[model samples]
Target: MAHAESVRVVFVDAETEEEFARTELAPGQLPDSFEYETRLDLGGESWAVVRADPPSAAQFLRSGSLVLTLRRIQTVDPQEMAYSLPTIFDPLPPTEDSTGSGEHFVIHEDDWRQAELVSRQLAGQVEAEMRAIHEVFRQSSRVVGEGASSMRVFDRIHVRRTPIDPLSTEVSLRRLSELLPVGGRPYAGVRIGDDPGRVVDSFVIAADPLVVYGQALGDRVTVLCLAPLLDAATESAAGLEQAMREFDLVLADWCSGRLLDASAVGAFLNQA
Candidate 1:
């Protein structure tokens, strides 16, 4: 198992809703760790986005709307920090020399079984939910710089459906960009097709947190989140893997809308 600097799980709405706000939400629905919070006015109504700062954990929950994120950051020395930091000038390097930097994972049959266990714990069950399925994987590596310092890089690939199609990939990628918070230099290119369906083609590059690529199918969308490892490293690779797996388990629940269940959420909030 490889060590992870941090693990982040996010849920995004396919379309923006006008009526989301923090004021309308009950504080009990949010995690207690969320001490610092703020709201943004999109259109005339107030759309609330709250954040809480806890050691090693961070959450950004947008109320009445479509985005929620859970992040675990790894704190490292300046030299180690180089391994995961993202710079505006540098485009993502080709995956030739940094082979050992990361790993790839796919949601498997056993994973679905584990998710079913999580669903069983939920009290308020999901009534009607979208059947969209999302597959997420990560690639991590350390890149040496001009000096002795190195930056750690994390690349995530999220796919909705399989059987890659060229025309579909192109059109889906375009629509994915439309939903993001705009304002960045646009970059695109095609990667070799041998690794179809995955983010094996052209992508976008921007400052630190980059939305490398996004593709949609039917009502489901796939997006890539690439950035530096911003958390402290664990003592062992197994420990890191444990942390990642736990996050992935919850992620499966979130994708299934099981996380919206009141009882199920208690478990996620209680996790350290």
Candidate 2:
């Protein structure tokens, strides 16, 4: 594939600083198109989330600081036929900001920089531990949350098939199947406990390499490379910085189209 259709950086924490986030972060600074306030409460256990969508980018700031996700949707015209535009999932409920001036969410050439800055800023205001960082690629059939607990974070690659205009279900399935081998239940998916270098692992959640049934309108088979976080015991500034650096290595390999069976996936994505 040429590059990701869209990339998102997500920050996870152990605490829910709903009031503090709402009160301190300004909402007015964001673009008016993002709307003044949107409230969303998924009910028990789920953190209350809020969303702000500007022309250049989109943001998800949740209650209790469960997570904060920043995404930049890449644009591809209909003629391109590679990927869909983008989908913006709703954020948590709105908070009460004393300043009422929301933070300015901008997409830079380097997303890592923005991610690091957000992690640092959030850590300064709250006592929550920086649990994990997630990088999401959307509208991408070839690639792919949160918590402060002592769980190992996996850097994953997701490959899926989504319906774009003019491509019917039958046609989409046929087109995608041509790229990889289709198989029965036994060979439907494969998982390599240890990666090529024994540095990571790989898993195929669904076997759509050639063909399969029960595929949703927007989701087909997906293969993921789960990169484990080895040195994330600390949640301080130093810890976060180290994690970010390690993540960069994983992201770089994925982006370069060099992971397990990446060549096969890339060939599929390159098709018109």
Q: Which residue ranges in model 1 land beyond 4 Å of their true spot?
A: 1-171, 190-199, 205-210, 214-223, 228-272
Best-performing candidate as measured by lDDT? 1
User: In model 2, what lDDT does residue 87 have?
Assistant: 20
Worst 10 residues of 1 by lDDT: 84-93
What are the lDDT figures for the candidates, one per model?
Answer: 0.29, 0.24
Please provide, for model 1 over 5-70, each residue's C-alpha lDDT reduced to its tens digit, 9 standing for 90 to 100.
333323322244222222223334444343455443344544334332221222323222223422
lDDT of 2 by residue, 1-272 (tens): 13223333233222532322232333333232334332232222233224432222233222211233222233456543432212211221122222322222112111111111111222222111111112233223332114554333123323311111111212223333343243323322221122111111111212222212211233322111222222222222222233233222111122222221222323322231
Best by TM-score: 1
Query: How much does each candidate deviate from the true structure in C-alpha RMSD?
Result: 27.6, 25.6
Error of 2 at 93 (Å): 20
